[model samples]
Target: MATITSAAPAATSDDRFFMRMAIVIAFTIVAGFALNFAMGRSTIAARPLVHVHGLVFMGWVILFLTQVRLATGGSLAQHRRLGRIAAGWVCVLVVMGLAITVDVTMRGGTPFFFLPQHFLIANPMTMLCFVALTTAAIRMRRRSDWHKRLNLCATISIIGPGVGRLLPLPLMVPYSFDIVIFVSLLFPAAGMIHDWRQSGQVHRAWVWGALAIFLIVPTSQIIARSPVGDMIYAAVTQGHPGEKVPGLEFPPSPMPE
Candidate 1:
């Protein structure tokens, strides 16, 4: 299987910069399937929430790539200006994330490929991690080293849904969600090794950020099947959507044409 990795021993600045770009570009390509869905390729219609979610996610991709280009070109003034805008936009992303998670679960858009409660829990956890890491990155903006690494950590956090969609992650596998999570780890794993190789130590930003991103997996598995999970599932998904969509079993969806 092919793999993604960060800089090797004594890699140049250009190498590190392009590695970061590759990470985001890879995510964008994986998630590009959403465009198909939007164009009527998928049965799921593009409702308001779905449209907003797509816009927000796509906006972040553009902002991330553009910011990387700006920083690499020494356009610090322009980058900071856009960074401020991106920071505010990050808040929108988080709010929309939470809203869509609840909305999807409530409406039974939680895929047949996932345990409903776990889906709800894991989906929002990514945003929580994103908000924390991105906020930390912004606070440490003057410390360019920490800022850059943490920003990488934060941007990669949202790659989970993309990875899950691209991979053939059916609900049948006993560890399907785990598989999605493990594939997603390639992002931070690359960053972790990059940090270690470059500085002879893993940056604490990557350490903490990777912890935040990775921990949600086991935590969801643990929490979503517990009493807490029952209450959460019971509360958010009610009546029709809840009954129509079983929490643990796969439901029929439109087969591809």
Candidate 2:
């Protein structure tokens, strides 16, 4: 009698895809924490609200890492179980994010190394975009492809803070406003690269989203300096104790032409 042979079960493609995603997520988390540490040290004397924002943002990073780990480790049921908690956590994150933006602007705490006039507008717009993308991602959670893409977009949206911190602020001061566009574009670039490597095609939505974010920086600056934005800023700051208006200055008594 001939001996019977047993074949090993082959791993599914989903397993390989999940493994790759896990690696990328892990790398991003490590990079984020390192950047945070470096920037936090430089801004050690920053206001309490800055620290609060950092803590909340770091909590989000931790949660993201945990979720990725859980999903990749064959804990889908437990991951779904924690989805509700994550949703509530995201709400708190949005609240803290908005509160930090308001407090920073009101207290004249926008990073001084950059052009405050543009930074003020860009920062808040970033927060708003982050919230919008994140909410949309959550809404499409049941649709795996849509959910994944939206979640990646949301991740890119929030990355400005991390990227801004990691960049050499002093070196970029001359083109501070433009740096926002550069940083925002990086996320979509990363996504495009990932998609190209994984599926041999770049997703159209991500391409569009990246382009939108790149445009938003300049557009937001234009709007912020416009009459309407000026009026809104003035109204919002009217009741605040120590608000400051940001603008460029010209020296008095110019040399004769």
Candidate 3:
């Protein structure tokens, strides 16, 4: 009988890469909270929607870290199994994100750093895009290259919120969308670099995915100004009768002396 040949050992260098990525993620979260505290942003006061959004987002961060740990531990089978749960969790996150975005915008209590007009329009769109990209990534899981790139794209698309907190709001306010564009570009750039190093050619999926996300800012802005956005804003705001639409006015402190 012919001798059977064993496959060569796969590269296991993802440990260092994942550890570095985890550090960056942890730093972003810490810096986000620190900046919010320093700026006295009112998100900490915690409306119901805000609480739910926070919990969902924090859970995502935890889940991401856990996934990285499991993958690095060579628990590929377990990681794939847990990914189903993570996929469900992502849907919940998107729902809570939309709920919070609508709740804050309608109440006219949008985050202080963001332009209320832009925030009202852009936030929900961001969440929707995130869900779409994440779902696409899940769908392509059997294709490792596609799965990795799409997941990176999804993560990069959502990094704006955390990056925004790191920026000085006063400086960023006039160029909020520009900041988002710049930060959002990093994912594709990273992908290009990875491709150049690994395969000597940039992946078309990363190129297209990044471009799509880049276009969304202007698209969302136009949509926000359109009658459709106005009508949706009106409908949600109408739920609270007699209170002025908050986006039309400056935010008020919810606490009283």
Candidate 4:
């Protein structure tokens, strides 16, 4: 009886915490894209491929929220079913994302706000990070310590674009993307703090996830501007967008707030 009663509270608390986190992720994604797309601020609407990419990503957001809701509601059976489906769905998402990245690089349709080279490196990296983390999360599903945090990190990984739109990326100029990436850390930071307060130490999943995000910024920044980067950019944009746009200039300038 004692064990059952104590376990009940712990289970309830876990559900509450996870449910609230899911809400945060869902709201952030939906609201960010709604503002960007509805306002015609994001250049994604201009191209058919980009439009499809948007739909696929939005589907992931909805699926993620649904899975979280199902698990928290104690519908583990339904959640596992959805998890199987998501395995296939996530593959589609990653493929669509990479395809769009290639399309943008070749066509030079990158938002005038971003340097084509930076877009080439950074965009794909985000997808790769998300894929790796999510794969680990799925594999370690039996270990809730790793499962939840890794999944959250993976989902949050790709939100940089949406976040970039929400913030005044232009106002920051050279450090624009970096600022948005940093701000996005708050979500994971909350998780880390929760883990600390609850367990007296941060979980390995949070540490790994946070380390990946922390490393991404500096690593991409360096490579995006190097000679090798220049060579890749030249090849990808041969007679393409880079030729037309200076790759680093804000000539098309961000719009007024």
Q: What tens-digit string does per-residue lDDT give for candidate 1 at 141-245?
A: 998777777887787777766766666666445576788666666776777776676677876877787787788787887888888887888888876566567
Evaluate model 3: give its lDDT.
0.69
The whole-model lDDT of each prediction reads: 0.74, 0.62, 0.69, 0.80
TM-score of 2: 0.75
Residues 1-257 of candidate 2 have per-residue lDDT tens digits of 22222211112343445456545644555575577666565466867877787787877777766765676565878877877787787777888887876665566555655544455566667766766666776787786555656655665666666565556655565565577457657666876776687668887767756765676676777877788667655654555642454533111222243
Model 2 pairs in collision: none
- Model 4 RMSD in Å is 2.4
RMSD of each: 6.0, 6.5, 4.8, 2.4
The worst-scoring run of ten residues by lDDT in candidate 3 lies at 1-10
Lowest lDDT sum, 10 consecutive residues, model 2, at 1-10
Candidate 3 C-alpha RMSD relative to the actual structure: 4.8
Score every model by TM-score: 0.83, 0.75, 0.82, 0.90
Question: Comparing candidate 1 with candidate 4, which one achieves the higher lDDT?
Answer: 4
Top lDDT prediction, candidate number: 4
Alpha-carbon deviation at 192 in model 1, angstroms: 2.7
Ranking of candidates on TM-score, top first? 4, 1, 3, 2
- Candidate 3 C-alpha lDDT tens digits along 1-257: 22222211222433545445655765676678667778787456766667777778888877777776676665889889989899999889888877877676667666555556567678777877788788888888887667756776776677777777776655465566667667768757765776676557888778867976887788787876778767766777776631374443334434453
Residues 1-257, candidate 4: write the lDDT tens digits.
99899779767776788789878877887888788877776775367877888889989988998988887786888989999998888999999988887787787667655677788788777788888899999999998768878988888888887777677676787677777778878888988888776667887888888777767788777888888778877877777655665555554754655
Given candidate 4, what's the lDDT at residue 135?
Answer: 94
